[model samples]
Target: MMVGRDVQFAVDKKPCEVGKPILEVEDLVVPSKVHKNNAVRGVSFNVRAGEIVCVAGIDGNGQSELIYGITGLEKPTSGTIRLEGRDITNAPIRERSKAGMSHIPEDRHKHGLVLDYTLADNMVLQRYWQPEFQNHGFIKKNAVLQYAERLIKQYDVRSGQGPATIARSMSGGNQQKAIIAREVDKDPQLLVAVQPTRGLDVGAIEYIHKQIVAERDKGRAVLLVSLELDEVMNLSDRILVIYEGEIVGEFDPKKTTVEELGLYMAGAKKQGEAKA
Candidate 1:
């Protein structure tokens, strides 16, 4: 005897069509706020459209700093970052956003959302300056609410009070969903996702995974930083193993094993040349 319901498993995903590079980072060095040595040291890579390029490493191995450097959360000490061939190494966060970059930050509270704001407001936090959401410095409340409701429904971001609910009051998973909804709806060409499914339940994880894959299939360039080995293997088109702020190895997910990746991630192995 087996249990059956009206359900379809969510693991299957359409393959993405990878194209030219959308984001380029060369010789990036980000200093650690807490340590004397740099956090990200001479790191470099590129994320092309229609592919998920994952930076796999243990926590505290400069993954956060790499993302920070690329997304303008922290200025790089040296090297250049380019989006669609234009240099944006010193661009502000808002400038990066305007240049087709969307970030799903690791710390949702610290960087992803303003807890005190209503759900509707948070939905357009990055785009409120646009003419559609604002006019002559006044927020178009009705338009904002309508857009938020649309995202909430599409992304399944559940809240007790709908669009009026405070962001901090929502469940952790729902809050993550809301952030993703906001970022994805921006129609970015380069999506920098750091731990996009970090603390969600299985169902939420499945949903988020599908959403990321869907973005890739839409020809978006996805730079994924993750600690989960299974996710790294399952979702990545290519994997770059990081150790002590440097990329130690690059592997095709279909050809590499977890143990092999673990060795590189732990500083036990280093390829002679890890291609970008």
Candidate 2:
């Protein structure tokens, strides 16, 4: 179990003029080895700096595949992924990370953390090779511990052994918190958080939500992929509803009702087509 103080922060509602696009996915298509058809088809969207654009849909609607493609875990059958106006469709995973992209993967155990590694080591998984954390191929263990301690304290990640704890021994909520701390601390230009608050307690949820909003306030573009209706409604400035691997509707969360959004998610409605 995780314990944290109640966090109350108002989401900024004032309309923000989105600046240059930080991420652009054009005509993205992902083929499935297990399925006959593509997992994602012709999906396109732009995430601008200082805005949070959410892709909302039910589970199994290509959200995971889309994230994999963007993060370079899986190759897209056809598409172009551009970061800050540079085409990075075929860039390697490390190349994308160095180009200012951070990901909080959906499956924490599978993709987010290396359970066997100490918390301090996992904290710098993406940056451990950098000059600050290494010297001529040797990892600066003290530097890693200091950085992990700061994040653990700041993010309220409690563990029996502190920074030395193996991540698998920590509670689920703390593990998620650790992932958030590590990814957010990177201060990436585009933060791709998929199902970030899933299966966590309310307190953890609140903390993570605030951190994501804080990122947008810092002029970072956020691409949120969540199936939770409440999270989609409360956190997103704009919502894109994906159904059967295609985006069928777009709405402003402030003006759309859950019932209407549900219609889109259920494939009962489309943005420009007549409702059945």
Task: State the C-alpha lDDT per candidate.
Answer: 0.92, 0.91
After the best TM-score superposition of candidate 2, give how far the Cα of residue 45 lies from its true spot, in angstroms.
0.8
Q: What tens-digit string does per-residue lDDT give for candidate 1 at 1-276?
A: 122333334456666678999999899999999899999999988999999999999999999988998999998899999999999999999999999999999999999999999999999999999999999999999999999999999999999999999999998899999999999999999988999888887777878888899999999999999999989998999999999999989999888899999999888889995555
lDDT of 2: 0.91
| Winner by lDDT | 1
Error of 1 at 51 (Å): 0.4
Q: List CA RMSD, all candidates.
A: 3.0, 2.0
Q: How many clashing residue pairs appear in each of the predictions shown?
A: 0, 0
TM-score of each: 0.95, 0.95
Candidate 1 stretches with Cα past 4 Å from truth are 1-10, 273-276
